[model samples]
Target: MRVVIALGGNALLRRGQLMSYENQLANIRTACDRLAPVAAEHELVIGHGNGPQVGLLALEGAAYTDVPAYPLDVLDAETQGMIGYLIELELGNRMPFDRPLATLLTMIEVDPRDPAFENPTKPIGPVYSQEDADQLAAEKNWVFKADGDQQRRVVPSPKPIQVFQLRQIRWLLEQGSIVICAGGGGIPTYYDEDHKLCGVEAVIDKDLASGLLAKEIGADLYVMATDADAAFVGWGTPEQKAIARAHPDTLMEQHRDEFAAGSMLPKVEAACQFARATGRRAGIGSLDGITDLVSGTGGTLISTEFDGVEYRD
Candidate 1:
């Protein structure tokens, strides 16, 4: 089976955790442990979120006066390599010695006219108190959005238009290599007026980009692993509950208002888009339920029909 797994930010650096190599390494090792069985049995392409990683880099860059802070695109590329290297090493440690592994620095194309450039809405960096976020926003001229009780910096999160080097990714899978690409939504890039490719100061929604990649690669299944076990309604209240399964339209109709736009909304939206677009199943759940997710349980499952049966070997 071909599966595309999009890791949540927690997979790398959990919320409020220190962004230290030791912390990140511990997290990546656990992630690879969960992924080893899947990689052993299936053709896998992994896409991971780097919000915290990139945000931490941005903070580091600000401490220097030697050169302009690297653009978002450059930072995206740097994180891809940085995170992918950890995944490659850690995942390799658990699998066959000769099993192929490749970390491709994917570059996705975005429309130069994308409205996201004008209104930044994607949240990155660490979550902060409202006061801290507001102060940082005022000082840096950055946009801030409420993330639950906390706030985070928001940047333009444009949709991915094209995934470059897809053929190479496919080829690597064919060669039995475990591929990790499209970290931080494939390093957002665009075509300038001169018709030359250039990087942009924007971020792409990793779930959306991962869904697009799953479709482009003709994956049988797509999974968005999150810190939460399921997409819940009335979250944190007595009425909070998990939606075990629902058609994309059903989910939209019943629970659209319940999801957080910055957090769960885009993820559910992406899962719905992938299921509707490809007539396949997509799941959203905690990373612990990885196998159940692919098997059509342990999360909110999206499909053409609520009763559709999942076929597995």
Candidate 2:
């Protein structure tokens, strides 16, 4: 079986946690411990979120360098390499099988005229107090927005149109190698008039990118490893309930109004896209629940048909 897994940012670094290399690696090792069995069982393609890491690298570069900091697209590529290396190293050490792991410096094509470029909504970097956020915004000339009790930096998150290295990724999967690609939602790029590829200043939502890749590669399963154990209906209300299994159409109709646009909405949308596009099962669940989720006991599973569907083996 083949599977594409999207790792969430908060799964690596929890909110309010100190950002440190040692800490991040430790967390990654723990995640790998839980994922080893899955990797052993399937041809895996791993994708990860880079909201905090890339922002921190950009901020540090700006602080120390005389030249302007690298653009977000460049930072996205950098984090793809950065996070991919860590995961590869840790997973290689833990796995009993000797598997070849490689990180593709992936580029995801997007419309140059995407409206998201004009309106930034994806939050990146560490949270700051309102006072600090305002001051930093003034000094750095960046757009700032309030999120919950803290302020965060917002960046353009354009939708992914295509995976540039889809063929290469497919080849790697066929060879039984665990491939880590599309980190930080891929390095965002677009075509110029001359057909040359050029980088853009936007981030692609990891979930959406993962969905596109899953569909393109014809993977049997798409798994989104998030902080929650299962996707819920009536999410925060008193009637909040977990969904064990549902068709993509059912999920869309039932939870359309309940999901927040910039949060869980993209995940659900991605799962639906993958399921509907390929007629395969897609899962949304906790990172540690991979075994249970695959076994049909954890997370919310979305299928093309809810009745008489067998779990992916």
Candidate 3:
């Protein structure tokens, strides 16, 4: 089976935890331990979130460099390499089969006229206390928002239109290599008047990008590993329940009023999009539930056929 897995940012670094190299690697190793078995069983393409890491890099650059820091798209590319190296090293070492593992410096195409460019909504970087966040906002002239009690830096996260490296990815999969690509929804890029590809100052949702890649590559399964064990209906409410499976139309209807924007909403939407676009199965579940998720016992699964979709009884 060909599976494309989107690893969530919280899966790499837990909420309320310090972003340290050692801690991040340890978490990745744990995630790899769960994924190594699947890698042994099928062709795998890995995608990961880089919101916190890239934000941290941007802040550091601002502190040390005399010039303005590089744009978010460039920072996304850097984190793709940075986090990809860690995952590649660990996966290569732990894989039972001696398979080729590679990370592609991926670029995803976005519309130059994307409205997201004008409104930045995606949160990136480390969480800061209100006082510190306000201080940095004044010093850096950044748009800041309060997330719960803490504040975080926000950036433009444009929608992914296409995967520029889909051909290379398909070739690599055909070669039986474990490919790691499309980090941070790929470095957002667009064509200039002369038709040259140039980076933009935005990030793309990794789940959305992974969905595009899965559809492009004709993947059989799309697995999104998040912090939560299963997607819940009536989330955070007394009647909340876990959804095992639901057809694209069914899920859309059920979550019409319940899904929160910028949270599980996009993940659910991406899974539905991939399933509908490819007529295959897509899953959303926890990193540790990989085995069960594949076995149809865990996670929320979306099916091509509306009637075939399973839901909590």
Candidate 4:
């Protein structure tokens, strides 16, 4: 089956792990250990998150003070190339030499008038002391929001409208190449009043963008491989329960308010959008469960085919 897998940022660098080349390389090797088999069996398109990677680049740029730091769109592309090369290298090592692979720097369009621009909620870069955050905000005219006891830089997260590289991606897949693109929501861009295409100072939700990619590419299956194994109802509580299968609309109606807005909610919503849009299966689960997820035996499968919500044992 044609499959599109959206690898969460955690798949490359888990939380609490030091962001180092060695660590990320090791993780990609591990992820490829799981993904190579899938690529061998089916047409595969990969999308990945770059929150931590992009933030790290921004932080490093901030320290230089030699020139104005590159914009978020540029940093997104950098992470795509940086992370894509690692994944492509590692995944290629396990596959047959004849199988080809390619990574594209995708561009996604967003509405210039999107309200998200007025409200910057997506956090990026390193956390800082309240004083430092305030100082930076004053000096740079940047926004900051409290992240626990510390503060973090915030950027607008607008919806992804169009993927500019769809034809290229489709052509690559037609050639039987394993493709990776749409990193960090495809380098957010939009046309200005002057009708000139310009990169926006924003981030796009990777899950949402990946869902759009899945739909536009006519994928039979779209899965978000996240840190969590499954989408749970009453997560973190004694009544918590794992959902094994669900009809997108039914699942939302029954437990829409249960998901955490910043995390599981987006994944669920994205999965539902794809499932409803195409009447195909979309899954959310841990990266380790990718094999079973493809087979519909693991992860929480969301689709119009299910009767309703079904729980796991």
Choose the strongest candidate by lDDT: 4
Q: What's model 2's overall lDDT?
A: 0.87
On TM-score, the stronger of 3 and 4 is 3
Residue 188 in model 4: lDDT: 96
Q: Please, what is the whole-model Cα lDDT of each candidate in the order they appear?
A: 0.89, 0.87, 0.88, 0.92
lDDT of 2 at 88: 89
Model 2 quality (TM-score): 0.95
lDDT of 1 by residue, 41-142 (tens): 899999999898888888788668698788889889999999999999999999999998999999999997998888889888888988888888787787
Off by over 4 Å in 3: 308-310
Please give each candidate's TM-score: 0.94, 0.95, 0.96, 0.95
Candidate 3's displacement at residue 129, Å, is: 2.1
RMSD of 2: 2.6
Q: What is the lDDT of residue 194 in candidate 2?
A: 98
Candidate 4 ranges with C-alpha deviation above 4 Å: 127-139, 146-150
Q: How many clashes in each structure?
A: 0, 0, 1, 0
- Sorted on lDDT, best first, the list reads 4, 1, 3, 2
Score residue 72 of candidate 3 by CA lDDT: 81
Better of 2 and 3 by lDDT: 3
